[model samples]
Target: MSDADDAGHRRAGRPLETVLTRPRITAAALRLIGATGYESFTMSGLARSLGVAPSALYNHAASKQVVLQWLQDHVMTMVDVAGFGAEPWDTALRRWAWSYRDIFATHVPLISIMAVLPVTGAPQTLRMYETVAAGLASARVPTAQIVPSIVALESFIFGSAFDVAAPADIFETGALAESSPIFSAAVRQGEQIQGKARADVAFEFGLEALVDRIGRLRRP
Candidate 1:
């Protein structure tokens, strides 16, 4: 073929720019979840948000579950596990719990999704668990109790994360206030006596209590 004809053929076969990548896809997926939430987050919606065909997402992820696993691992990378090796076990647990709850407070949807999802393929998530488990073992917690204790602590953290988003008047009894005067008064008192937000104060209280209880479980 002539040089001009060869150039024309090369141009015809040139691939389109690769706009979709794992990072970009994950970012777009997170934005879609943030904007529309888990209930409305579908592969089709994600593709629409990324301005690509749904087939493009499939090129990166096999299914919605796979994308969610990627998101879970990415999110796990944000949780604070720095205290595990440097601080006392209790202190490390406290630091990790606070960071975990804070990160998930804005990602409540992921909390629900991840609650049902396993950690088999999520390496970051598994790393977090390993750190916490090692910390517990180092602290002399019973082998049988470590997993349950972790689960219990996580249950509190997840609930507290949701509570962080609750309105200040979430406890308002409205017309029923008069019927439960004691509870209403306590709520009002709690609102007034705070350096930290009420939800935070409650979280600290619960976390400390759990920590103390776990400490008592130490082997002799």
Candidate 2:
């Protein structure tokens, strides 16, 4: 599915308040950035990708910086989409984490851009802020504890998916049949698990860890 497919919400036509908020524009920019990467990302390039003339986009955003700002907002919105699944507060967090990771994993090009980029005033950067606020307001978690707990868990799941998608080096390795039987068996079955199955395995593993992390967070 397209990135726009994942945008997941919309208002009919344009609203007078703003033709495009930072988040909406950013979501579009993300599709371009993810598809083309920073090196290829330019205002003209984005316009073409969106099937609009370059100037048309200008009505919504003025510059690449503006587009970038919107993209940051869009990233944060992924959290909102995560919330749509709506389980209990704690359960929702896992579903949220999995949704976040899955969304990013599906858009690897954007993830690559985000790796070194520091997210500033983008709408979504306030994710932890919002989550913690909601947690506190809802009395689901404590002021002293929520921040680090979310950060640690978020980083772990994101990092795990990245490892699966773009391993530091997939080329270097030999089977350890005796020392690591599971690893050896995986090596043998490796070809069978190639293609979408491998991706599903990676995705499911990440999802399980993400959802199960709730128990860990609540424990010590």
lDDT of each: 0.84, 0.58
RMSD of 1: 6.7
Q: Give candidate 1 misplaced runs (Cα > 4 Å).
A: 1-24, 31-42, 48-51, 62-65
Residue lDDT tens for model 1, 53-168: 88877887789887877887788888999998799999999999999999889888678777877788777888999999999998999999998899999999999999998998
Compute each candidate's TM-score over C-alphas: 0.82, 0.56
Model 2, stretches more than 4 Å misplaced?
1-39, 47-66, 80-86, 112-120, 127-129, 136-140, 167-220
lDDT of 2 by residue, 1-220 (tens): 3436334323444433234445445666777776766677898887676666677778767888667656644665665434432446655665666667776665554554554455455436666557644753354454556666666665765665565576533632464447777766675576565655454566666566644554454533
Q: Where does candidate 1 have its weakest 10-residue lDDT segment?
A: 14-23
lDDT of 1 at 174: 89
Per lDDT, the best of the predicted structures is 1
Give the Cα error of residue 75 in candidate 1, in Å: 0.6
